[model samples]
Target: MSAALPQVFPHAGLPARVTVYEVGARDGLQNEKATVPTAVKAQFIDRLAEAGATVVEATSFVHPKWVPQLADAEDLFTGLRRRDGVRYPVLVPNPRGYERALACGAREIAVFASATETFARRNLNTSVEGALAEIEAVVARARAAGLWVRGYVSMCFGDPWQGPVDPAAVAAVVERLLSAGCQEISLGDTIGTATPGHVRALIDTLGSRGVDPARLAVHFHDTYGQALANTLAALLAGITTVDASAGGLGGCPFAKSATGNLATEDLVWMLDGLGVYTGIDLPALVETSRWMAGHLGRPAPSRAVQALTKD
Candidate 1:
């Protein structure tokens, strides 16, 4: 049998130090109605780094018609003040997107695939197998170019169009991603419909398949107000990395009723209060979230910000 995972992760007992990948600048702002200026995006990155995000997803190289807000991804990456140890990863949808990211000096990149056939067809316009074949080429090329790659398996917990997703199906895509050389795989709760029970079962099942918990991460949207609870489940499953958006800024545009992602400020606050070192400055994080909210003509969606700002 695989080595027994620590009954109580000392890291957790001593307050786990989770790595939070800030996806606000890219994932959060992508679906916005207003076009967030490239200069604004650059400043946002600077502030996110200052607030202690070691890895910030800066932008996507998706087509303009799909996400016009981030059409100037090249400009956004080019304008950022590059920090020595901090990573600025961008989402590259295909080979063309990968080429654009390389031109802009992207040191790390992310690609996405879905678990359900319906989502694969609807989101990527291909079957699950076809999409994986294409992603294999992309990942191979990216690795050859010496770029760090991350894989996203969306709708892992459940799908709106396809109903309940199979754990075996989730594991199959994860295996493809890992085999294709993605250093880390992030399982996404795309529609925000997952419960803590589902999160636990999926992690355990993936573990049984020999997927190291260390290389796995969770991305949950708080649509049903269960993101934090699901995060706790991930910790129990020995996952230390998570994907959160500053100010809870994004949702699936296809799922109109969906809510924004789990708020970074909120997640950091909980981690900090528990003595978990997220390496993020909570006050500065709140300020950045509020700044983005103001820029978008919306209010910050983080409860921690509301509570902290109220006093």
Candidate 2:
């Protein structure tokens, strides 16, 4: 990305700047069936940072049996060329994972919980309260270790088994994470069933409970092709942080109906057209995702990347 250029949007009540949290290295790649070499993952991180990603989710500290792809979290963090302004956060399932991440010199990390009881049972063989308790323990230790912690509430909009989820249910986990020392909470539409109206309702639920939208982030999937639309709703609702994956590379291992996340390229295209500053170079991101798609033996799923790469 080049020097920051001033931006002025003709639209009213929109933020001038937005933060794109890159999740390609962790949430994106962890769902791949094939193993991506640690070196490739590390290089992916390097390119994302060079492409002007300020916050990149590097890896996870889950057990190898659970998420074999990110089992080498320690090695990946060690080999990474740490950027001065970039933040690399790892995902930890419990205090054990947090301990491993802390030992690896991790400065920031994230813990995930679910809003649906079925998802919690299927994903972790536990209840929502059980998962929340686990993450709370990890967050406590992470805070005491002087590390910044983020929390994720998956299946926020709707669940396949249980159908539409209550906004208050999502807010319960969000508040729990915040009370457990999470500085930011990412609400995820795991199966991509969310629309602009649903996004607003969820944000309103939180806002009514005194949860500031500024400390919230939205992670939407593109299964039904509504990720960007939902993101725009989030932005208009006063959310400044958006989570995306490079090349549209992500799915949930636990959620069978999951799909790739909102592509960073796709989000950047919309934001750029709106005269919003994201400090990201579109061309660079396309080239990087193109390279990644080649390595993964698949075409990049990002509409912007495909449109830009085609002659």
Candidate 3:
């Protein structure tokens, strides 16, 4: 059977290539009610790499008490048969988590931060400034060890408890991450309430604060059915890196209203139509997500995956 593909229609003023950071294994599965086996997580990472994902977030090193779904972090990382030219980054929430990631030989790591105080307190068990302090220490030590570090700022667009976050406030967090030696920062719409204009305005605000758009990545949730539109806005604003999950499979564990991430297949379909290079095979990616959906005992939430896979 022949596979379906998007008709290319090049859009001007957009990047020729965009990096799709695959987060299914880590962020996507972290919120699951049932535990995904360690071996299955390893296989999922391998499948994502086979489908041409250059960067895949493997697992989180946070304590098992916080996120039990990924408690097999050490085993998963140890057992993973890594592919060459593919980068696998792990999340570290504090010094203890960083030590665990370092022990697992992670080459790249990410730290999660919150732009609002309420989110910080709820997610990180600290105030916004306090979380930044911890993240600063982790990033500093990781950089010293010659590992590449990425920073994630959650609730950049809106907070469930504190609605409609200010762009300036998000930029402040971005500045702190940059100052702390993070190579890149992903701005997350945790509750998915952002629109295209808000995305553009936030990028502009970050730029005005002397932060380059190149160092920024967008992580949008599809709660408001606006993830793709907001992503387009980010692309037009010269942001080339996008964070997506394989099956639209992740939501903020701390924030009840935040939905699944912008699906990888859906994002790839859009990029394919736009004539932007992502180097991922759309058919293979769809198949991988379908396989993962079966493991989860649920249908994939990605519209592209659903439409293309329907027989």
Candidate 4:
């Protein structure tokens, strides 16, 4: 059984253990210009699980028209190694995608809704309410299949077209996803413009709406170099789950100007030093990122990985 890292002392108002939700294989690679081979993607998932990632999102079931890179999701899931305790969830936009994910043996699924109507239209060609309506059905169907459901609220903080967002608006979508039977909601900082104060306020808003921090996860981007700081705020606000991509991979496809995700390696390093257990193998994780970075023909963006692997 996995154990929490030993707490050296009492951490006032901080969680003892945090679950790092690794999205490297799915969220990390979805936006890449070069399409990764099916075999390579499977290998990456295996490596992530071997590095002690209990929840590794593998691939999305979205249509090829939306993300052609993950067109081989079925093939990737069919022959990949399944770790005993690790969960591999696929993104499903609608019922058709959910059905495809189910056929590929997916036991957990994720559906995303946007906070702003503009992002809703731009990302999925639907209004916020319309997207939530579709996700509700997907969640209901997946729950009926006894599959775990995760929901994502995109553009939770600020949007490119619609500058500055109301926390209540984000919470409204989150509530709809939860009412549809999503066990957890990931509030996504799609444009990477959220600050620590913004994160705290958003969490407070959700809390005020009867949403516990336990059922929430923070997904941040490093576009303005505030991802880690914002994450610290979430941790202080009692958030236990964090969504990160290995090697800091991934950028918003809809919001092209945004930078990559907050690197898992960087988050792990901070948590380790803070005595917050994540059960991740730091050196092994770094090695995997370096290897994956080599495949991308670039140096790893994670400072932790680069520092640990520096010549």
What are the TM-scores, per candidate, against the unseen true structure?
0.95, 0.96, 0.99, 0.96
The digit string of per-residue lDDT tens for model 1 on 130-194 reads 99999999999999989899999998988988889999999999999999999999999998989
TM-score of 4: 0.96
Model 4, position 140, has a per-residue lDDT of 83
The alpha-carbon lDDT assigned to residue 152 of candidate 3 equals 97
Give the residue spans of candidate 2 off by over 4 A: 1-9
State each model's CA lDDT, in order.
0.87, 0.91, 0.94, 0.90
lDDT of 2 by residue, 149-226 (tens): 899999999898999999999998999999999999999999999999999999999999999999999999998999
| Model 1 alpha-carbon miss at residue 48, Å | 0.6
As a whole number from 0 to 100, the lDDT of residue 185 in candidate 2 is 97
| lDDT tens readout by residue for model 4, 203-287 | 9999999999999999999999999999999999989999999999998877977889999998998888788888999888988
For model 3, how does the per-residue alpha-carbon lDDT over 147-261 read when each residue is reduced to its tens digit? 9999999999999898889999999999999999999999999999999999999999999889999999999999989999999999999999999999899998899998899
Clashing pairs in 4: none
The C-alpha local distance difference test score for the whole of candidate 4 amounts to 0.90
What candidate 1 gets wrong by more than 4 Å, as runs, is 1-15
Cα-based lDDT at residue 40, candidate 2: 95
**Which window of ten consecutive residues has the lowest lDDT sum in model 4?**
1-10
